[model samples]
Target: MSKKPIKRLAFENLTIEFGDKKIVDNCSFEFPLNRKIRMLFNNDVNKYAVLHAFTQVEGITQGKYFFNEDDVTQFSFEEFMSYRLNMGIGFSTRGLLHNRSLQENLLLPLMYHKMMSMDEALEHLKKFYEYFDISSVKDRRPAEVGPNMQKATLLIRAFIHEPEIVFLDNPEMLLSKGLYANLLQLIDDQVEKGNLKHLFFSTEDEDLSDCIADGFIIVKKNKFEFVENKKQMRLAV
Candidate 1:
């Protein structure tokens, strides 16, 4: 078989601070794109901060962020917007548009970035609607849905565009253990197809990391580091 391409997304001595409070200290690490990696966070605050960093919504105080060896430490809003099409980001249901139905929200990315017609977008959604369980409730607005359906909507929004890389920010935060397990299996199945790369950030324990993650990232004491031994991750805390 031909060798798979090697892709790198890294943070070089990156520092993220608010005023004098350092959220994530000077840290550097690369996410291996050959496998799905789980970034473990002890608290909710740091987890989302890292997601914002990936999306360039929050700027770092020092150091550089790189994608494919290109410096992207200080991307402008417009630049980042254009860049995010190849990147998918998942947020809490709170991030979903309250006034729009799930179908409309899912169609936005395909319409905006891919320039697909409304009918075409809906047709495309048919491909993965069952995977996310959003087809039945796709017409419901945020207020009309429960947390499970809302979370499904968020997943649809993030993945509808079929971006090369996906950043899932606590995708299972609102899910039950069983449902979350199913989600993990689904993620592994998708990764096995070698079409998408995933970086999952969650406050859950290391047990979840062992499920399908090929590597582990630990964010502790205001710094980020990779855990060499995936087995020691649970005790690393």
Candidate 2:
């Protein structure tokens, strides 16, 4: 018999409601361990709510989810933390502190897990800083970096943790149209080199369709559709 590949993450029959509005409706998908994916949605999908569903850090009104093949409904906070350790979650607010250095902020998450030594964690941070081309700002405070650099640094923060699946919640939200292409190119290089599988979503991007592994689903009026980037050919950057 052939070996069954690990089911890295999934959302099955997920539906979330706020008052009478169903922000997410009966959504189902899988994140395989070795694949990179981009999820594109416009105004109606409630992007952050979809983001919350993956972590189960936010409560869902009705739905089922799994992380690394185990049901999320059965996990305790400790279990959830353990799950997080196995899968690095590099959220937007993951890095930086008002009074701390970028390097220090990067180490805080690893220290919170209590699994890596200080030296090991520092070395990891250093590598990501170099990989993402953010070493100059790594020593500087986030407030001191330029707007575009800040966004790139956030990506660096994500990459440093070595996440099997990273969620990029519009890290490029503040960048200009030109910078968008550069950031994507840099990230594509990093993903190929670092062996990362990630999910990113954006409302106004023109180039992500070609630069990343794209999978689109639009949820409006409680309906869903799977979109293919190639099918969106006439669209231009």
Candidate 3:
């Protein structure tokens, strides 16, 4: 007998609100497994709030986030930490540790989780440095590097741990054209190797979305709606 495939991440009767304002109002959506999704929002605040909620950086006022049939919103602290380790997040403005050097910031998650020893972690990251071509700024702190290098480092950090799902908020904001192309290629390679199962990104760049998104999650009329990519649908047909 063959084993059944696991279900993907899902939001059930989800509601996120601030004091008096609701960002996600009783929305329910199940994300497709191993697919790249673009999050489309008419409001920037709604975009940031929704992404933060998905990442568990912000609390949901109501509803449950189910990952692989488990309710993550109810997870214990340690359990949540473990859950987060499986996710890689690239923030639009901030995520890097200001006090740590670029290389150290990249190594922190692996070492802190005891995923690997210092030597092993360094060895693992070597390919990323070469691929992103940011080795020169490795020893510098986040503040010390220019915006392009900082963004490159952020991208590198996101993929270094080989997380199952990567959530990127405005991934193309400060990256140069060359770096952006490299980022896309890196995502493709990881997906092909089965290291990355899902990718969700919020971007204003339509060209970027068209290039990669297999589906879309759109915020419409205060509710979250899933839209299958027409391009993918055509390809499948």
Candidate 4:
């Protein structure tokens, strides 16, 4: 058997502020690798705020972030890009490029990351297309494809390079339950095969708490807390 990848991530007294208001305040938690985590938020704003902070859309005002035992707390966006390619972020693809073909949208990332050449990217795309049964619309632009296809494209782009950690933002809102289940299965397979070490999915649905494999994180009264039950989370919310 192959040894599993070690891609540990931790937040030590992490805080993010928007002017006078603090979005994430003094949050401290370490996400366990080789497990699935559900990130529950009190509201949509909080959901987006946490995701943005992780993706560096906003700045961290305090504390340290450790990845693979290294303090990357002060790393800039450019620094993150040259780092281990440890993280991947996914959002709804409804607003994908209208001018570029779907294939181009997916191929560009592979090429930019130096993961594959044009011919290699095309071959990789073909495999994913066949796996998702999206080959028919592979050449079409985003606007021409249906919602399901768009969601598939987005997911493929997110996981094509097989990053150690993946951050999914409101995927349930973008894909149907069937698609969501498939996505979950994909993550599970990756985890089992040691291809993915951690998966963090953020959402506002209280019911999603049941899907937590290793507990869930929630924003309670503007503070991030990890919990096991939705009822207790409701009290904090």
Q: What's every prediction's RMSD, in angstroms?
A: 4.1, 4.8, 4.4, 3.8
Better of 1 and 2 by lDDT: 1
In angstroms, the error of model 4 at 73 is: 3.2
- Indicate which candidate wins on lDDT: 3
lDDT of 1: 0.68
How high is each candidate's TM-score? 0.84, 0.75, 0.90, 0.82
lDDT for residue 214 in candidate 3, whole number 0-100: 86
| TM-score of model 1 vs. true structure | 0.84
After superposing candidate 2, which stretches have Cα over 4 Å from the reference? 1-8, 18-21, 30-33, 88-95, 175-195, 198-200, 232-237
Instruction: State the TM-score for model 3.
Output: 0.90
> Which 10 consecutive positions of candidate 1 have the poorest summed lDDT?
1-10
What's the ranking of the predictions by TM-score, best on top? 3, 1, 4, 2
lDDT of 1 by residue, 46-69 (tens): 555666766754747888887766
User: Which residue pairs collide in model 3, if any?
Assistant: none
What is the Cα-based TM-score of model 2? 0.75
Candidate 4 residue pairs that clash: none
